[model samples]
Target: MTTLLGCDFSSAPSRRKAIVHAVGHVDRGRVVLQRQDRFESLDDWAAWLADDAHLPWVGGFDLPFGLPRELVEHLGWPTSWVDCIRHYASLSRQDIRDAFAAFCHQRPIGGKFAHRATDGPAGSSPSMKWVNPPVAFMLHAGVPRLLGAGAEFPGLATGDPRRIALEAYPGLLARSVLGATSYKSDEVRRQTADRLIARRTLIHALENGDPPLMRDAGLRLRLTHSQRDALADDASGDSLDAVLCLIQAAWAWQLHERGDEHWGLPAFDPLEGWILGA
Candidate 1:
């Protein structure tokens, strides 16, 4: 019995905008969300993840695990994943922005960002982007903590083998559930009826195992009415995103249970790690 988690992360977490974590498990072909909680600080969450009590778990975290290999090579950074992350950690946000901006400036207009192979299928933001979503800051803030926590990343590295971590994107799963349907917003007024409907539809799809990955595995999500409403009504969508990642974690666990090697991850670059389910 392995504990599974999905995390909707914020690079800069606070009481106003906390990180949401969905804790759950797969039981008798159902993915159950045991609870959802918020962490107001990354420090607290990192400590919790590093604790011995949290072992024997797999977590799908909504943050990029690696940057584009092209970007790393172009910047003359170390090619080794660990070393590359170390170099990335050493640089300030401004430094990163300038570097990435320089890279983009040298490239053609249609392709301003250097991308990882998984980006094509995952539709994830470029890990180097320092603004908008500021995922670059996420990589800087999150990956180091993951390394310090010593969690294992399948096909990437082995750390606390009982505690596994994988990169995940809720948008990937959400898009599969509801193509081009808007389901969330941070603005109060933008939390409209249509987005709520989209959330309900997405939740139903998960319950019915509508995604090919869920359907193929004969797994469906189980949630109470209140839980569904909470997921739908949260305009920030952090809670719902966390649950989506939880489902992804369950899928990975299923693959592991069935003795599939690499835990369903494709052969990947050692530096530019692959996203789970990408």
Candidate 2:
């Protein structure tokens, strides 16, 4: 079976540190077992994320799929940016660039374009950008790759929505464990120690059956002995990050199973599209 996947992402190479890890979903309650893949270059990463042969696993990637409604509408390409998005999906990379550029050229300063919060959570740049966070660059870098890879956009398309790709909020996962303590560690040396502790904390919480994490959620896990040990053993919550993606996947499944309309956006996003947690 194609299991769900969670990824701990980094735009930079990891010669000194692990760059990205695709944590695979295994037994009961995702005991992060195998590292699915890794990348030292964005080109290689983009190429991997775009491949269709590896999907149908409902990958909860740490990337933004849509721009803000405010930004899209402000640019005036299509009042119904959603519909425009559908059409935009069919365009080539160059075409998307030209159109998005035109949109920016028409807009004012301090507001080149708006971005999704997932951008920050995933460490990606604005979807409308071509530089800086280059999230616009990432979208340019990533989405077309998703399309090329034949990854389904459940929000936009109908077939194999099972290849489900959604914008995940890692903050949702981090907050559950750290509770707004600012667990993000960018200092290089501090990253390993911080990750190790976070993993320990989450394991402890999971063991005690923490309500927010274990009780209220509807999903269930069926972990093997090795799987369970692996989770606690991994110093970096790379496994946890993947499992966090899995939990978000479960949350998405729960909302969808609830018969949410408008692609589960109302429950997931009231102002934005289906945000995790609040």
Candidate 3:
């Protein structure tokens, strides 16, 4: 009953901002993808996540769980990273935004700030401070809930570490599938074709019984012919992002159950906490 979940997250808190994609794995290694259910708001997503006892899921979130230590120190806040995040949660989002902006404003234009350890390892920007990608906001918006929901923050360890939540980049899998091809587009016509291509590629990979997926995953998208036709009608991969997350989650589930815990590897900042996943 172990299932893997993925979130193609947004910083905003509307139903449109939260989409949950899950893949279920039975006793043996099988991949069963769940439907993409968009929530009405962040609270709805929280409500769903809070039901931790129901579904046996281990999730790989797309947002950063910790901030750069340097960033923490700059704010003259507690040296502990998790403490800083929990503190910010008590403040308004606007206040957090203003503080980060001021921090950045004081820095030199180029190489203005330090980044979270996850960012360097994942090739993503810091998820605690907004600048280019605004991944920082995503962390601000996302992590506290995971913690609140009792999802294991391996590094933080304030919640149930067994709830296992890792940080995964869907791009890693998409790159392997499409190989530098811009198969995921935002334009309607282009995105539609890319999605169809992605779907077929995934299906083909599944039928062949890929290593990550055994031949027994009792879950699927169950896309209708018309749904397939409709998915093809758009060029952006917002939908594709969810599907990609499903696949990524499946991959991570395989490792999480088997991988050795370093208590946080490579970028182990005792304060920020450890990074989990394969």
Candidate 4:
């Protein structure tokens, strides 16, 4: 049995909004939810990721693993993914914002941000966007830690064989079930009855493998009553997102078991990583 991880990441984590990780393992066709871990600091999270005890695990992390190739090339940054990420990790957040702002300033309206090829299929925010989701900062903060942990990112970088990291987007999975219906919000004012209902609907779909993607992969979520309640009760959706990622990791692991290297990913640009299911 292989350990599996699903991570809902935050670039800047505080006690109020920390990184959430869903830890589990696949049993038969069921992805069992063992427990959830929260890290209020990046250092704690990084240390946990690097821990050798978690070896031989595959993780689905909700963060962009690479920048848009166009963005990298336009900035005259190193074209190699690993080197480019290293260069990116060295910069302060202010430097990243200024550079990206300048890049957007020269572009026309409705095309302010450069995107990766996976963006269309994955429905993810631009990795360079510093506001709203601030995924750009996510890439800035998250990737370096993964690299430091020596995690292997298929196609992009090679590192520890036992620890495999795949770029995952839970929104891609969630949107399939909800179809633009809002399910979660951080603000207490925004967390309503409808959103709670949506979360329940989503959980039901996962348990039944209702989505075509999940059904096709023969994956179902197995949660105890307490676990189910915990996932649904968290209005922030961080825990649910992590479980979604865990499912993605399980899907990828299934493919790997069947011996398709690159773990179900297509021939995507090495400079810009691909989402697992997308």
Top TM-score prediction, candidate number: 4
Question: lDDT winner among the candidates?
Answer: 4
* lDDT against true structure, model 4: 0.94
Model 3 deviation from the true structure expressed as Cα RMSD, one decimal place: 4.5
Off by over 4 Å in 3: 15-17, 129-132, 185-234, 262-267, 271-278
User: Any idea how many clashes model 4 has?
Assistant: 0
Clashes of each: 0, 14, 8, 0
By TM-score, rank the candidates, best first: 4, 1, 3, 2
- Higher-TM-score candidate among 1 and 2? 1
TM-score of predicted model 1? 0.97
lDDT of each residue in 136-235, candidate 2, tens digit only? 4344444445555556666444435546666565666566667755433445566565565666676566544462634565344444567666765655
**How would you encode candidate 4's per-residue C-alpha lDDT over 1-278 as one tens digit per residue?**
57899999999999999999999988888989999999999999999989988778899999999999999999999999999999999999999999999999999999999999999998889989999989999999999999999999999999998989999999999998999999999999999999999999999999999877789989999999999998899998999999999999999999899898979899999999999899
How many pairs in model 3 have backbone atoms within 3 A of each other, for residues 3 or more apart or on separate chains, i.e. clashes? Answer: 8
**Model 1: runs farther than 4 Å from truth?**
none
For 1-278, candidate 3 gives per-residue lDDT tens digits of 66666677776755434554544443344455545566656677778788856466767666777777887787887776567768867777787778778888888888666776655544455556575567777777787887788876555555565466666666555554455566555345564655667656654554355423232332234344554444444345555555555555665555455673532234467655433322
What TM-score would candidate 2 get against the native? 0.64
Cα lDDT of model 1 by residue, 136-168, tens digit:
899998988888888887776778878899999
Best of the two (2, 3) by lDDT: 3
Error of 2 at 191 (Å): 3.6
Q: Which segments of candidate 2 are over 4 A away from where they belong?
A: 11-23, 26-34, 42-55, 78-135, 192-195, 206-214, 218-239, 254-272
lDDT against the true structure, each candidate:
0.90, 0.55, 0.59, 0.94
Full candidate order by lDDT, most accurate first: 4, 1, 3, 2
- Compare candidates 3 and 4 on TM-score and give the better one: 4
